[model samples]
Target: MSSQQQEKYEESELYRIRHSAAHIMAQAVMEMFEPGEAQIAIGPPIEDGFYYDFDLPRPLTPEDLVAIEKRMRQIIAGQHKFEKKAVSAEEAKAMFADQPYKIELIEGLETGGVDEYGEPLDEKPEISFYSHDAFTDLCRGPHVEHTGKINPSAIKLLHIAGAYWRGDEKRPMLQRIYGTAWKNKDELEAHLGRLEEAKKRDHRRLGKELDLFSVSPDVGSGLILWHPKGALVRHLAEEFCKDEHLANGYDFVYSPHIGRGQLWEKSGHLKWYQENMYSPLDIEGNEYYLKPMNCPFHIEIFKSRVRSYRDLPMRFAEWGTVYRYERSGVLHGLMRVRGFTQDDAHLFCREDQMPEEIDRVLDFCLHLLRGFGMNEFKAYLSTRDPQKSAGDTQRWDDATEALRAALDRVGLDYEVDEGGAAFYGPKIDLKMIDALGREWQLSTIQFDFNLPERFELIYIGEDGERRQPYMIHRALLGSMERFMGVLIEHYGGAFPLWLAPVQAIVIPIADRHIPYAEEVAARMEAAGLRVEVDARGDRMNAKIRDAQNQKIPFMLVVGDHEVENNVVAPRLRSEERLDALRVEDLIGRMQKDIEDRM
Candidate 1:
């Protein structure tokens, strides 16, 4: 959003309504508990809704949420006018003496430090509190003028969960109540409907139901075990991507999984990224670490050979796997995994070639994503943070402009995230909107001034002098594991014909038809289709149901009639049945679907 748009939203009635709803929920919680029993913490309005944390005497239950919401409705009905008052630091501390969490916030405000929630206050400002009815708490005011302005039916208590104070494991866990407040009942209903749809498409549930992948206790958390079916889909995706990269002038390369500690030091990973890295192992007399990235090794490859300006644009691609330590609590299915393969590539180009190269790569990223059935895309340009970023000011400015120009040249809409760039360089991150309208960051094209300079990467120019080369890091699919997970959910496990592990299943009506089913499967397999034969001793309908459950694209049913006429009845996953067709016609149709990527 632009600054003007953001200002309009922050000043809108809906913003005030949500903010006040948070306070109302907090008030209801206090009334439910005995005085001093519920230590109120920070309650803030977030995107789309609000949440409040509390150090309560006990864990809240579903019944407790109902009661609290009921009390909030009553308070809203009372039409209490919100009142704000300024207070001195000493006075604020004394007023909230009974509330330990409030007292801590007050002290932090006074000292210009972080509060219990770890929200920083660079400088102490005037302390204030907002009150409505008999409830009062520490807060910054921009609330509704009166509770009557809020629609009671528009607010709902969503759910309850445990959250550690300040998001630190060492801190005490607090109960967090999440709620959504809308302007009216209709909007709330629409939001709830979307949530229901999202639940049905959740990747974790579909991953298990479709038997694509699993996280086993024996293999350790965040380490995914891709079953055979899942592996096949993944392999197809990789094959498609590799073919595209090769066609686009990328030279495929391979590197070891572990590297010497000095490699990371030269790459600056040790100083800036050690926290996410695992401890190094002592091999012989040297230290080796699991490679956390593929950039350093790619750089080593470039340095291994001296080249003139003719080799200025060197694009090296690899499906490199890396490991990083992710907290167990945050270990989601495939989204936040410890081990994964990145579709990583690096391009070494001259200064004059930077803009065109970036534009080409951006186009390639969009084309590749579209080929994977993801058509919606938007780019985010993250520029350097002055205080934290490395590299010279001129280089940073040039790189930022190059990224912006690439987006403009491609006629792509993008939002600029000022000061959000990594320490190394500016980047353009492409996000794909899934079927549920949820955005996933899938591709990133970054300029790396730090790495080239750190490694002293140079290329001989036409003038015979060695000049520094610009390095562009691009990851089109981001990671194979996460992209597969996204694909599974996006299609609800019903992949397109080309990507489906089992493109077709031949189901025999009776035991005597098994030979015919196998023959059909063999014919299909010979035509380059991944076909399976269901020879189990089950009824025809049961076999068809099992094939449907597996989400196979086509089910070719064969029996005495099919065997005699060289024809089979085809059933789609959508339960649409086609007229009996000759084997040659079926193959042609299936081939067309695969060619079209349907």
Candidate 2:
């Protein structure tokens, strides 16, 4: 096969393997349950694995998973050949009469509707079934010729969880069996190892253990309550970003959390983004909404006064907090939240300055991300989706080329996402690869032509003609809550010296040394270090352990010898100890690290 053909064959193989694995798992599940006791729903191949949903008579347990997995291996060993046969919708319905979910799917296929998995057939296509031995399922197949082709040892069922049918809460809840299938056992083992490491570094667990944040039942779901330490870290991050923005020629701006319905309607947010927005609240006689984005507010700032070309490249920055409605099932700790503060900014520049501005913004994004220890970067240029976009074709092409040129000028690697742009215009999305080789999208520079036109925003040029300046929307850190969550997991809660909530802790060897430790902490604090003196009556080792648990970068141990000499024995979190150093010397070292953003 040619290279392209070979690539397609390999992809088809993996898809077939995963798709076949789901069927085998479903068959095993049916065998384990009593006749007519379990009804199989949709089984689909997703990223990294496959999952099959079933409406079981009872909740699945760990022991049940083991049993189902054992039976699946037995079925694989039987070496059943997969047989495909097309059937009319009427025949499919009759064949799956006992299975309500399958019957529902057949009905959808007959009526040219969407199935529970969201697979829609606008015009009814041929319905088919794939059968292996006595087990069969409605499907469109490109499956392995036989079950013997599967490597049973390379596949394992991971876990079982509750899922609502079609992802709708109102629908019947089903048991979803999540499993991973690989071409070989080694790859399976590697994937399992990554899962273990990911679990250990799970931000939700670290958040609670480190006392950084909490999501309480009383506070409602998808809402985060940053603890004191977490709040300090968040505030420090915002302060650093604000300082950077100011230095980069951005004017700080503020807007209310709620705006009148008319504001959203004028911005086209109500028409285009209403599904993600929260229901409007009625105040007096008008409707108000919790702002889902800060773009419209920044646009209002741009329109506050008419301007000549002198103010063409106006940058407005805000650490604006916004709210949106998220389904309960998808709300992860801080990674996905209902309310978050976006490091949002907008740049309005003349068309002549558009290319240069794009280049500058891309460079600035890389610089800011590097300061956070995210140096590896790649960008995706999302061009306008022809069917959904609103702007004229020429403007879209120009904006897309500007973004591409910006990436090329910076010598950055990028891929084009042909139709990934928002409805308004094209955009460039930057993804940062973290310490674990996981990619996180942290910055976006989007071009908008539709909004300015909708709002009738115009600036007078030197030629005395009203011209619509190109509007660029940028979010550097994406959102405070999500970024903090990523940061917590990125460093595994052992933040670098500059970003650690408590940079150092002073530990006294005894009660007599308490005053000296406090003095040491005071000196460090005066030097702008975040230091705390551990004054508890606990043993010295216990205090050190507590500081380590808190991931404090430096632990300053002050004994009589050190105190008398006005020095501290510095202990690093990595368990490295240094000889007694003068307080001034230690502070200077810390100051250097902070300056370097270590």
Best by TM-score: 1
Error of 1 at 541 (Å): 2.6
Provide the clash count, candidate 2. Answer: 0
| CA RMSD of all predictions | 4.1, 4.9
* Candidate 2 residue-wise lDDT, 65-183, digit = tens: 88888888888888999999999988998899999989888877778477546677566667899999768999987688888788888898988988898888899989999998988
When summed lDDT is taken over every stretch of 10 residues in candidate 1, the lowest stretch is: 112-121
Alpha carbon lDDT at 177, candidate 1: 96
Q: In angstroms, give how far residue 408 of model 2 lies from its true place.
A: 3.2
lDDT of 2: 0.88
Per-residue error (Å), model 1, residue 402: 0.7
Clashing pairs in 1: none
Global lDDT of each model? 0.89, 0.88
**Candidate 1 global lDDT:** 0.89
* Model 1 misplaced regions, further than 4 Å: 1-20, 45-48, 57-63, 73-132, 137-156, 162-174, 181-193, 432-440, 559-561
Model 1 C-alpha lDDT per residue in residues 61-129, reported as the tens digit of each score: 999999999999999999999999999988998999898888878888788576546677666667899
